[model samples]
Target: MNRRHLRWTVPAVTVFVASVVAIVLFTQVGGSAACAAGGSASYYSAGRNGMCNLGTPAEGLYAAVGRAEYAGGKACGTYLDVTGPNGTVRVQVVDLCPSCPAGKIDLGKGAFARIGALSAGIIPVTYGTTRDPQVGPLQVKLTGGTAYSALTAVLNNHGNPLSTVELQTPSGFAPMRQGEDNTWTAPSGAVTSPVTLRIADMYGHQATVAGLTLGPKDFQPTGTVLYGGPSPSPSDSPSPSTVESSAPSPAPVASAGPSSLPPAPKC
Candidate 1:
């Protein structure tokens, strides 16, 4: 069942109650109209592996965000709809550009080419987190796991920035700690084989995914798509991203000065 119905044309919240697990939905927020600081956009050449370390988004549109916006790894895996001289393209945050200023962004070579002239090197642009994003089903892969022991999970294609991931235990929901790479980890005996995960996004929308076994070489689809709909045309005008407890994600407001900069991400 789809959790977030983007086409509702109104702020929505739906709970997919199930007899299999106790699912509690949090205060759901509306999606972002767009998230941007309105800055110059330049292209970068990485080894193709970004600081977030995700190789590349399947759709291929991706970018390296600056410190003020990255919010440590908080911005990782989130998708942004950027509008430039040519058009709007949705790109995932895959890398970090440490030298870039607060509002500036570094698009992947291909992404930059789509928005502006590559030879131009840089172009003015507006960008923000997208709504009703097009993504594949949620994928959960065990980075490291053993029967009833400690383990780590790499979550993928979870349309929105995740707020939390907890493993179900006999006692209750055992919270999983997010690692630097953005993977979630649980300590020894916190869970057993084929565990269930209670996942929540920043917007507070939650879902329960079960039957995740201890073994899987490739990412296994959970058969759950949080939500999707005709994305409202991303805002073309430059605007400071607006964020609320429950709203579409514009990148978090950037603070002033070098002190406002987040610790440089180790690429």
Candidate 2:
């Protein structure tokens, strides 16, 4: 009887799991025939500068898409019309979200607030591109390079996404490399003064901004029309095919003449 054994019992703990549900919304903008997709939208504060490097975060009209839609810089500078429970807002694809799943758009804080409440955190949205949006005049900005050589620029307010950019040099038309953040870099070569730029969109619509004198600063009020549609009237807008001649030349400015770079070695 002297040997008494003592035993202790522990109570079992309960575990709980939280379920997350995401709703998908879909809608077409401007009565366009383009296909619309349902997706989830969230907001982020990633700073004013984005992958496109065109608009700022303060503008509240920029968005970032998933890697699939980003296509590197291919999706940059493109516009998406997103509609939420509150209203519809058009936003530009300026950045990229590597972790965002397909069919999801991460919008800037300002842009998200326009469509839904900040407290919502995440919301359902329907998004698609609008055909020939009235984006007003084309504004071109020189982001890198000097008037002397190796210029990089970003074309804005063009409504449609640019597919290619060619610079008219003394030698010939040289294609520019579309870089991340909506910047187009000039090929390794001498780009003569009085730069002429020919920009084309995915729809084959082209716009030529002639007579640009590259300087170490920005250029605005370019007075270039965003060319789109078939057979624009001669007085109204120049046709994409014949804009080279019809478009007016930019004002003359001093340049670093005859600057050249070593040719890029063949891979």
Candidate 3:
């Protein structure tokens, strides 16, 4: 995956507005609309709200999405569009102040990242929801024995039902069998016991299920699985990530004061 790194630092300027009750903080990840597609994940905040550690949430976890970039590389107002509990939100880099480091976005108190489990600073995030952003009615289940649990999902995209569906486990690939109720199931038995899994739309869209402890006892539904199923593995068991989550890794977010600068500059 080609990852682009960019950061915007907005200077705190107190501008008095007649009708405005409060002065709001604004930060923009400097870039053209065309360039907003894919940049390295980072954090942005408005005021001196709360302090967050770096890379607490793993790379493939979920983060709440808030505030949209309307146009002209600026926001009309600070609007937060938080999805479900562990849903994916695509936020644009409007202005950049409260400048945390990479893999972090400081949205102040009203807006936050790690909404669910708060063990780490950062979490993994997908681009969109498991199903369509407007319409999502997908369900995944894990059954069968503990050694090779079967993961299944029913995908309904818009009105068109996809004929062939595929499910992914951490170890390898399995074809999903479409059921009468517009659902699909992956083949049973695999190398690993429980595996991390994901499903794909006809358009090659992928979604993830986080922290699916697929052992004998832990084989049950936990959080919402958007487009993908669950795949549990012993070695690669998903854990919370800080920028330092990967070990021997430099801190993605810098400490405050003199070193509080982004590794990458504004695009």
Candidate 4:
């Protein structure tokens, strides 16, 4: 009696393993965390022209979070929707309120007007991250330094709070350091003209801005918007992907003069 040879297909097994790996990676980096907290809300004008040296505050759409929610610079670009007795308003995190108690937020004049009267001074409010809010393209402002030297940058209009920032240099990608006031500084060797930037947020989403000509006052706009959705579980969604194309245009040079606005009020 002859026994038939048993055969196992290796190609099918290989394909199955690859698919599993891809799915695992995607689940690891595809979603954002949902943040909600209740606290006292107050209004301030200090960030009226924008905080953290990013730019002028978007009237009625900006806020300065306290230590509890600010989480250092991690919460810099995150948006929060605040609800009070009067109504609810959405505001971007532009600055920090050093003295603000936990769960407290300081809204700009415009933002306060939307939710409550400025005369209220302070009011009880509940705030949370906006779910999948529509945002504009990423704006990268070269705040300090010049071409051919160490440089500082501020990224605005990002849908989620950035967790890391990297610059594409002639040699390769270089990591940047986060500084006070929502600023990021490039490493020494990475400071060069006509650079590209790769920015990633806490939600595992990323975008690239190319063709940036480094200068004391240069700015670059990536013609793509970022959309960050609600929190993701380990088994949900796909891996993080780049949101936009690499459109590089000259941005207005930042002024080197001190801020003309008066000091922001403390809580």
lDDT of 2 by residue, 178-249 (tens): 865667888765555577898876554678888676553543546776553322221312112211111111
Give the backbone clash total of model 1. 6
State which candidate has the highest lDDT: 1
Computed on alpha carbons, the lDDT of every model, listed in order, comes to 0.58, 0.56, 0.29, 0.56
Model 4: per-residue Cα lDDT at residue 9: 26
Which 10 successive residues of model 3 have the least lDDT summed?
A: 246-255
Name the lDDT value of residue 209 in candidate 1.
89
Q: Sorted by lDDT, highest first, which candidate order results?
A: 1, 2, 4, 3
User: Candidate 4 overall Cα lDDT vs. reference?
Assistant: 0.56
Which regions of candidate 2 deviate over 4 angstroms? Answer: 1-37, 57-59, 143-149, 228-267
Q: How close is candidate 1 to the true structure, as a TM-score?
A: 0.68
Candidate 4's TM-score? 0.67
lDDT of 1 by residue, 1-267 (tens): 111111112122122111113212111112222333355677665443466545564323667777656665667667777777798766777667776665567776667777787766666676665433555557777756565557887676665667788888888888888765666887666445777898877654577889888766556767875554433344542232321111122222222213432221221
RMSD of candidates 1 onward, in order: 16.6, 17.1, 17.5, 22.3
| lDDT, candidate 4, 1-267, per-residue tens | 111111222345334333321110000111333233355666766522344555434453567776656665777766666676677666666677776655667776766777766665666676665433445578787744454567678887765557788978667778999875778988764455676788876555567787666654534666855443234322211122222222111121112122442221222
